[model samples]
Target: MGHLKDMVGANVAELVVVRHGETTWNATDRLQGQAESDLTEEGVKQAQAVASRLAKTAKHISAVYSSDLRRASETARIIADAIGCPNVTEMESLRERHLGNLQGLARAEAHLVEPEAFKASISSDPDESIPGGGESLNQLHLRSKHALENIARNHLGQRVVVISHGAVLRALYVHAKGCQPAGRVRNTSINVFRISASNDWSLSLWGDVNHLQGTNLLRASQRGDEMR
Candidate 1:
């Protein structure tokens, strides 16, 4: 595999993409879409575990990029420290899908925050933006693809880690797989992919949580809020 990639030279880039560590919102079944949430104690431990996992890979990471959101920036910093990177790049394009007025509310209370939008979001059309400031699924797909392509293009031959949110990660997976949905992504789970010069993405791994085996926090629900 190493030689095969070398054959492509700088035309290919290796990416290690991960969802941010679990947050208070994640723990409470609240919607975190584009909202702020501190990482819980367990979340910090999860980040440490993933950091340790990346430290053992022996790959020279060129950079660490994450969403501007606190949860993701925090996770990226943890990973960057373990990998000896001194800085993290924050990008809003990598943010979770905007959940509009429903953000920060528990699933049970989401309807009350934005009744119509919440109901419409359940089965919104690809182009139909969720009411109350939310983006459409199509918008997310395009943003995910463009954000990843930009990252791969900028890094070229380097290997880098990108920490983002569940919704953004899921959008990437869906876009790469022709919009086919994958399983739920757990906090701190590792995902790997390679991007060709043509901007095509080949997934090498998805939602691997082996590093969290002993943490007893590997499982993540597939519910809508959890996905966000």
Candidate 2:
């Protein structure tokens, strides 16, 4: 709910978290969940643009990590290559929230099939889970916390880039800000956070896509289900 900068000591690690670029599912307004989707052509260009921006702004990034999902991994690879980071460690914990029966469904279809379940899936309750074996918002928050803490501990005082999904990042953002995001996270948007030596987290930036300006790559969709 509060900025970590106000709560942490000087010893801190900087984390640059990025949402993956657009995919076919993103363009089609479908839920992707843990299912895989390749980056669209525009998505590739977006990744390149973000990589260029990060290369100039975060040249000191010590490591790159990404969700194992194709979209996230592909984005991470581009950024890693541009920054000369050489490797991108894939972490399953960074993947988007498992959508269960909602995976691959169109937004309209999901809501029509089970309006209550669809509503709960998009609610802010940390314990709310998608029906049919999906992870809860609380589960997502915990995994994000663990993944970030592990990175901070292992790469103390360093800057690292983490490529993840919108839903996952949204959960982390909620954990940091103690509220739901004001809007959807754009493709290749960067969020900056700091983890103190005591493991406190603070958000420095959120949903930043300054590099995408004039690129016309940002989507206008408000479908929450598309974030998976």
Point to the candidate with the largest lDDT.
Answer: 2
lDDT of 1: 0.79
Question: Which sections of candidate 1 miss by over 4 Å?
Answer: 1-9, 219-228
Worst 10 residues of 1 by lDDT: 1-10
Q: TM-scores across all candidates? A: 0.91, 0.90
Give per-residue lDDT, candidate 1, residue 12: 81
lDDT of 2 by residue, 84-160 (tens): 99999999999888877788888769888867668778786868888877888788889988888888888776788
CA RMSD per model (angstroms): 2.8, 4.0
TM-score for model 1? 0.91
**Residue 227 of model 1: what lDDT?**
32
**For candidate 2, what is the lDDT?**
0.81
- Per-residue CA lDDT of candidate 1, range 12-106, in tens? 88888988888887887888788898988888888988898888763778889999999999999999999899999999999999877677778
